[model samples]
Target: MSDPIETAIFEKLAKADPKSVGGKSIEPSDVAKELQPEQWQRMLPKVKAVALGLMRQGKLTITKKGKAVDPNSFKGVIRLRLPTEAETAAALAALPPVVEDDDDFA
Candidate 1:
């Protein structure tokens, strides 16, 4: 099971729309604040870590200055958003097709 805080971060990103930001993206701070206004700052690091993990899984995108960055190494300001439909399709297309092996018959 995933951490509740991490799950919340993913939920927020999934709900955001690019058109809402003039076709840009939403910031991590925005999700944190929405989840915990009183201690949003304290929760930021965890949220960012969760976002980065999601990016690595190809379910999220981290952008700096409107361009995607290495989620594991990015510094300074950044934004988080769900992969676009086309982006998702492209990623899925890039994956090796799954094949069942006889070992699974055990």
Candidate 2:
């Protein structure tokens, strides 16, 4: 159910190569630029928003100075990465079940 931008952010972060960035993390700008080469500059804010939301959900980790920061107070530069298996599992467990709507107009 992710929108294009959210999908793009995760795709970019998931495919990040550790050797290239010293770790499996990438800058928000990287995702923005890949989604819109020419107008990439405008995508930075959206990228951060998705990243922060994911971090709040525990599916992602946002870091500053190689340590996890409080999403509510983070500022300046940041890096995004997928959480470890255990962390992801915990996050998944915490999420409410998705209930599909089944309205009928008979």
Candidate 3:
């Protein structure tokens, strides 16, 4: 079964909002605070996986000025920023058309 909390984090990322997933900006302290202690135990690895998607898309960056930064760190308010027209178009264009599969259940 998929972890609901992890799913929530991914859903937030797929919409381009990192802060919504219990993080401030990719800061460890912020994430630890935003997520509950129990959630945190399950959140770390999940966040790391989703963060990779963000990194691949160039929407998030990793830096090194002192201690290593957590990719899930976020800051400020949680806003769901919609994709721009061009981005939406590109994403839509990349998707395959839906196909019927009679051999399997819906």
List, residue by residue over 1-106, the lDDT tens digit for candidate 1. Answer: 8777667766665566624332447788887887789999988888888877766666777888887786547899998766766655655665568997767655
Stretches > 4 Å off in candidate 2:
17-23, 85-106
In the range 1-106, model 3's lDDT, one tens digit per residue, is: 9745444544544445544432223343234334657567466555555444544343433334422233356433232222344444544554567897779655
Given candidate 1, what's the lDDT at residue 64? Answer: 87
Find the candidate with the highest TM-score and give its number.
2
| TM-score for all models, in order of appearance | 0.66, 0.71, 0.34
Off by over 4 Å in 1: 18-24, 85-106
Give the worst 10-residue stretch by lDDT in candidate 2. 14-23
The model with the greater lDDT, 2 or 3, is 2
Q: What's the candidate order when arranged by decreasing lDDT?
A: 2, 1, 3
Superposing every Cα of model 2 onto the true structure, what RMSD results? 4.7
Question: What is the TM-score (0 to 1) of candidate 3?
Answer: 0.34
- Candidate 2, 35-88: lDDT as tens digits: 998998898999899888887787787888887777779899999877776656
| Residue pairs with backbone atoms closer than 3 Å in model 2 (clashes) | none
Q: What CA RMSD would candidate 1 show? A: 3.9
Q: Report each candidate's C-alpha RMSD, comma-separated, in the order given.
A: 3.9, 4.7, 9.5
| Candidate 2 global CA lDDT score | 0.79
Model 3 ranges with Cα > 4 A deviation: 1-25, 66-106
| Candidate 1 least-lDDT 10 residues | 15-24
- lDDT of residue 38 for candidate 1: 98
